[model samples]
Target: MQIVNKAVVFESGHEEYAVPIQSVISIEKVNFINPIPHMPLYMRGVTKAREDLIPVIDFESVLYNRSLAGEEARLLVVQTESLQIGLLVKDAKEIIDIPQEALKQMGIAAYEKTKYFIGVAAFSDRLITIIDPDILVSSLEGIKDIQEYMKQNKLFPA
Candidate 1:
């Protein structure tokens, strides 16, 4: 018997990326994102979802070094062990089952930022870069600063 992992595929720029479906809480359309001061450039701001305020990050900027243009961007609400944050993506494509065998370990040294990627998998006719949400959330610049802001603003419990 083999284990099959499910992933939510989304588009960012010209490439496709996947995150384990188990980590995803919901997919949401872009709504009003209130900008916060003194946060990282990639940190778009905060938004209310399901009666809770969540910080949203511009994943395109974090991954591609540029913010996404236009109004078609969507939010991928991901929940980790400690935190739940919104990741801005171009679009949410579909949920697909990827075999464990199909995932290939990527050489961390070869990539400029190795922490952002977990592995690669073949889906359809393209190779999708699998994103590690934990790393992505933890590695963001000014995360602590944002957390402090949230706490000060009573957005997060101290």
Candidate 2:
């Protein structure tokens, strides 16, 4: 028996990253994102996906401290503990299975620097940094309020 984790691979700048496939609910094109004022710079806006309005975070903005990049943009609609948030990325067309043994856990320094990183794993010839979606959502400031706003507005079914 082998322990393998299925993950959705995405690109941000020159680096590759992955999140548990189980966390992702859908992959969508960049239809339209309605910007919300006074939110975090990285929090691009809210977008409708599969009848649910999810908070979209610009991955490039978060990582590179710049606006969203890449020619083809996509939204990785991932379900965290309490919210179905959208992560806008350069690309998200690959789903791969990563073996448990392949994961290289980050040391204390790495963990201290990034709380959302689960580990690093080599897939194909590139390095993919595994990200924990729960921590990714929780680590952001003012995200809770966005979740609450969605719930209170009945944006999606309760």
Candidate 3:
């Protein structure tokens, strides 16, 4: 089977995960000074992008329960059904293509806990966790209507 060699891979501390490149819009450097109250700790913060204030999640903290130092971090812009979110990671890696058969789904149980990893896919001898942006977005609370939710919270300044 022909494999697609396009995915946005990034490093969070020592671990690496890949999201379908097609789902990404842009990668940016983010410094968040405002955050939503009563949200999960893994939810890093929020920042303004264009006319929208995007919610950002700490990829490392959510996955591994460790916060990465933000000195050399980057925000990966992933498109969700409702809004564009920035996933904060330590660094971004190269995009690569691997065979489709090499990917192994971790099943529903794994995804139920993490809610980030859609499946586990192999790349050569190493395994790269494949992330489904849709799952990530859907798992976030109150993201049903992204625009209205942000507006209700006044995530943007007047």
Q: Which stretches of candidate 1 lie over 4 Å from their true place?
A: 1-4, 109-112
lDDT of 1 by residue, 1-158 (tens): 11339889999988989889989999988878999987888998999877778899998888778997567788899986557888889888899888887888777725756576888886568898888787777777788888888888999667
Give lDDT per model, in order. 0.82, 0.82, 0.72
Of the two candidates 2 and 3, the one with more favorable TM-score, higher being better, is: 2
Give the runs in model 3 whose Cα sits over 4 Å from its true position.
Answer: 1-5, 107-111, 141-149, 153-158
Which has the better lDDT: candidate 2, or candidate 3?
Answer: 2
Ranking by TM-score: 1, 2, 3
Q: What does candidate 3's lDDT look like per residue over 1-158, in tens digits? A: 11335788888767678888888877777766376676676776688655567888787877778876657788888887666788887777677775677667666625466666766667666777778787777776655544465768786432
Encode model 2's per-residue lDDT on 1-158: one tens digit a residue: 21238889998887899888889998899898998878889988889999878889998887788888556789999998877889999889699878777777766425553778878887568788888888888888788777776778777655
